[model samples]
Target: MVRENPTASLASLASGQSFALTGGTVILEDGSQSASDIIVGADGRVVAVEPFLDTSSCGACVDIAGMLVTPGFLDAHQHLDKTGVLRFTPNPSGTLQGAREAFAKYARTAGPDDIHKRATRTVERCLSRGTTAIRSHINVDKDAGFHGIETLAGVRDAEKDRITLQLVAFMTPHPGQDFDWLGKNIDGAVALADAVGGTPAVSEDPPRYLDILFSAAVKAGKPVDLHLDEHLNAGVHLLDAALDRVERFDMRGRTVFSHISVLSALPRRDFQRIAQRMLDLDVGAVTLPAANLYLQGRDYEMLPPRGLTRVAELHRMGVTIATASDNIQDPFVPTGSGDMLEIARWTLLAGHLRGDELSAAHHMITTAPARLMGLGKDYGLKAGARADFVVTDCIDTDTLVAGGPDRAFVFSKGRLVSQTATETIREKEDA
Candidate 1:
């Protein structure tokens, strides 16, 4: 399970006692920076995080110099299984419907081996970019079948120690309502995946469809994450219906909704009413700015909606929200480099988070996503937390949100997982 990179150092960094990362600026949860030392025990957990530390008892003292360290970034939502198929399955129309039909057609011939290869490559890229964890949704339907589930499981097992990976068994609620195939395996998918996902927004009846999804989650005893009303001017918000199920099933704090972009389409009063309900019911939300902006308002001619949710307002209303990359190089979204910092940067722009709020924008990718994923208190830049973090050239929140440079080093469980060497290409001579 420990995948040792051929180019990585053969000599293991694991040792007895502890080690200290000295001389780097550590960014705390509060967005404040301090020149500090972080001590990692041999077991790969933080034993001390402070401005100063005595490193006399450590096995190694890694000098990170001017680098800044922050908790490893997390993609609370992504599509690992479908990454890297952009060229083969281009969406000429560049609309959501086109993507659905195109991907479904290509999937018929794409076998398990194909899915594994693409998913693993994406996992590696995400790790290289300082993301230590990911929650991916693999399509599960009559079209893709359970093969996507097995493919996701294989990639996660193969890279077990390098990062945290969770799967969401995703089946869009439409497309022939193939209940015979889906109904037979829906519960099985839930049992296999870390969470269950579906788009009730596309179903014939939204509220009733949510109840069905909820019943499945309760039966499988897994949490739920759904794609709800991603289209703009959607008449009804399934978010309201989801709340009814939460109360009916007592499934508080165990539900999440992604791409609820229709919240932007709601009237201000209605938006606040639903926002208050989201806070009261303890439901979490994830905004996929890249795909949302790309697909949502294509039909409109002038002044189309931004396709972004009210991120700033959601944060202000005490609702748990995180920004994530929903698709990477797939038909639904033609572009995404698998960088969480870039996703955060887009959230700042598309979601209108600027100025002093940049700190919270950074949180949308790191801290907020970590908490929404329920990684617990042991997952951030804190004492006794998991020794998963990245060292980059950017120092403060502003530069971090801007995503100016690549990460210099990535560490997981107190061991070096990835390291980068910078080289600038010389520009061509003057004409």
Candidate 2:
């Protein structure tokens, strides 16, 4: 199923031959190059990047005369399987509690085929949006049953080469439970996943949950990711506890806290202290603006808070922060098309990240997320790097973000895998 007006796919590249992209703006990590041509070899690695290249003996050539080319976007965090829940349930309240109830009900009623169909559609939509990499969290809790795991595995296989899907088996263990059984199941799931996930503060007590997850993470030798401190309550200050475990087990930088929403609730002094600790401990923060904002604060009405991590403070403290869309069309967040441009726009508005912060936010969806996923080194269209990237309509970072996703001429490993129409109607109306 190849797309119409497809770019050169990585598979089409033959050794010793070069494919040239005629004209587009190429955005590098540090700067942007206009009217550039990117050449790729048969080995699927970028052979050369210059303003002009001699085009000869190439297996295929794509003349994207009027487009903007940049590194393929990466959704650092998402929930593909749970997105299927949206087809049946509408979380009108849009609270965490409402989401929990809706997901529980929908998971029971939904089967693997249903999940497969929806997840596949979601992934395809993501790819069509020029998102080539996604770190998806799959629910492994009992409530989701086999449907979550089965759906996740199918998605992983179906979109493996086209899109990089790093699966994190997510679950929340009960407190005072038999540790052995919990560890066994979690470890078994880790054996089948790229990483391990837990929701330390999502449970009753943050301390106990962190302890269990940290112990399991240490034992399994897997990078730990906890849905830490998602509430606006300062009482659920699990960041310190999680760092304590990271120090105890020496996991350090390998641990990431997703949606540290309670970070903003901490007093400035306390926040600074924890930020320094996280910096020293090498822990990272993953902020899920889409789902966190939607799921938190069912009890509040006026001035509902942005349930996201303290991104500015974290950056000031030298901690790495990345924005993610945790749930797309799921109970947690009823709508998302796996578009990080949308996420960036929302982040810019909600987080008040402007100018340099905007630049950093742009990196958050591209290089920053890719590096966090441990796959960005070869991600861009640089010499010796894999020819996996996208061509968009906007020329500069500001325009790119403002323009949203206009078109998705995506190439994976130098082969044309998918393409999507940019919302040109919006562009027309804006004009």
Q: What are the RMSDs of all candidates, in order? A: 4.4, 4.5
lDDT of 1 by residue, 343-382 (tens): 8888888898767788888788888888778888768878
Clashes of each: 0, 10
Q: What does candidate 2 score on TM?
A: 0.87
- Give each model's whole-structure lDDT: 0.82, 0.74
Candidate 2: misplaced stretches above 4 Å? 1-18, 31-36, 51-54, 62-66, 90-92, 174-180, 204-208, 421-431
Q: Determine the C-alpha RMSD for candidate 2 after optimal superposition of all C-alphas.
A: 4.5
| TM-score of predicted structure 1 | 0.92
Output the lDDT of residue 252, model 1: 85
For model 1, give the 10-residue run with minimal summed lDDT.
1-10
lDDT, candidate 1, at 21: 76
Worst 10-residue lDDT window for candidate 2 reads 1-10
Q: Could you say which candidate leads in lDDT?
A: 1
